[model samples]
Target: MRKILTLVIIATLTLGYSSLNAQNYKFGHINSQELLNAMPDKDSAEAKIKKYAESLQEQIEQLQVEFNKKYQDYLQKRNTFTDAIREMKEKELSDMQQRAQEYQQVAEQDYQRFQAETMKPVIDKADAAIKKVAKENGFTYIFDTSSGVLLYFSDKSIDITPLVKKELGIKE
Candidate 1:
């Protein structure tokens, strides 16, 4: 009976140890920013945004120049005008300023929408590639180290940036 109890205890310990070893997970880290910067689509998106912003800026500048000209004219003629005409001119200036402000706000919203639309596909592609790479390599979890969310990771965790880049057919 003593020998049988000892064997049972040994068997239980062995199974527990093996179970613990089997629970080991494969983890990896990557810099998402690096992946984004390396993508060709990102460059095109940036160029498109830049051009759109320049066009909006040009329109704003035109509005500003018109406002300045009108203000200057008002200043020059205010001394000679009747009180009623002066009030009318001031109202016109105020309306023009309000319109310009509204246009600026609209332009900003449009730019933001455009940027989000342009980046969605690129971001989706990158995410797919990352997921594929992680699965292919048997990684249980892949963390974005560049996002500043991870406080600590062991050296044993693999850096899977190159693998993801390769999976995406990216050169660098």
Candidate 2:
């Protein structure tokens, strides 16, 4: 009776352990930044930003040139003019400088707003693609490896960065 009881106890423990092991979860990890970089539209987005920034810079340069021309003209006339005329010229130059600064600031702000607006949609699309891929692959959970927020994960976690990039329509 003692032998039978011992065998039964051992069998019960072994079955419990095997059952627990059988319930293993499949998970995946992705570096969101890596996926974003691999996106086909990434280069296009960067080009757009570059073009916008360059356009702003050109406008600012034009303003600077205009201001400089006015300033030099004012300086040239200052020595030959009366006190009232010189004062007027000085005020005009100061006002031009202020206007140029204001224009540059406004342009910079506009660029920032445009970037935020345009990139928001792209980011949302990428996020949706990640979710879809995770669902299709039967992933229990997906962690963002680039975010440095995951405290722990086993080696069994699938690195799905490339999969996400592919899902996002990245060819390379």
Candidate 3:
């Protein structure tokens, strides 16, 4: 009986170990920044952002020029103006300055929002492609190498960039 129990225990342990060794995990890595840069839509989106920023800058420049002219005029004619006119002119300049500042803040926020809106589709497409490649290739983990946080990934880690690009229908 003792010999039979020992054989049973030994067989059970072997089977358990074999089952554990049968499981497999695959890892993949990709430079997502490179992928985003390679996307054509990103270039057009950035161009649009640049043009919008330039337009905002131009409007701000116009405001500054107007403020400067008013300031110079006030300085030249202050001696001839009554107290009420002087106060009114100062208040007007102050109001313009305040409005310009407010507009700048709002412009910055609008720019951020526009950038996110423009980039969302491109990002979403890239993400979907990555996921599709991962699932299709049986990858257990796909890490982004662009952010610089990953300290050590062995050469054994498969590069999935090309696969993802192909999934996205991207050339080169």
Candidate 4:
């Protein structure tokens, strides 16, 4: 009876120890903002937007310069010419100004729309890539480090931002 009791206690302690050690939970964190910014495709999209905006701005500036020159010429002639010619030149200048404003508005709207369209797909792809990384790495839960809301984290080695970024083809 004494030997059986000792054996039972030993077996119970061993089973408890193994069970405690088996409770290994893996978690990961991702700096989603950093990854998104570092993506080359996002850089390319941003560059395209900037290029378009710059081109539109340059065209607008050129138009303004031409309009200013023509207006100055008209002002000089107004002093020496009939009221009809002066009014006609003023109307032309007003119409050109209006058209320039309209052009800028249209360009801004187009750029915004394009950015939204381009970003939606990029964001979706990044999300899918993150999910794939999480599943493959056996992460039970993944948190976004960029949110600034997680106040408690027990382990830093589980921060998988770099790994996820690499898997998504983002470098540096």
The most accurate candidate by lDDT is 1
The TM-score of predicted model 4 comes to 0.67
Off by over 4 Å in 3: 1-23
Task: Identify the candidate with maximal TM-score.
Answer: 1
- Model 3 C-alpha lDDT per residue in residues 21-55, reported as the tens digit of each score: 65577889999999999898899989998998899
- For candidate 3, report its TM-score: 0.85
Which 10-residue window of candidate 2 scores lowest in summed lDDT? 163-172
Model 2 Cα lDDT, one tens digit per residue, 1-172: 9999999999999999998876666789988887777776767787888899999999999999998998888878779999998998888888989999999889989999878776776788889988988889988888888888898888989988777777776775
Q: What is the TM-score of each candidate against the true structure?
A: 0.87, 0.75, 0.85, 0.67
lDDT of 4 by residue, 1-172 (tens): 9999999999999999998866766778888888888787888878877887788789889988988998888877888867887788888999988988898888888878877877777778788888998899888888887999988777743877777787887675
Name the candidate, 1 or 4, with the larger lDDT value: 1
lDDT of each: 0.94, 0.85, 0.92, 0.83
How accurate locally is residue 106 in candidate 4, as Cα lDDT from 0 to 100?
A: 88
Worst 10 residues of 4 by lDDT: 154-163
**Clash tally for model 2:** 0
Q: List the residue pairs that clash in candidate 2.
A: none
* Over 4 Å off, model 1: 1-22
**Which structure is stronger by TM-score: 1 or 3?**
1
**Ranking, TM-score, top scorer first:** 1, 3, 2, 4
Q: Looking at model 1, which ten-residue stretch has the lowest summed lDDT? A: 20-29
Clashing pairs in model 4, backbone N/Cα/C closer than 3 A? none
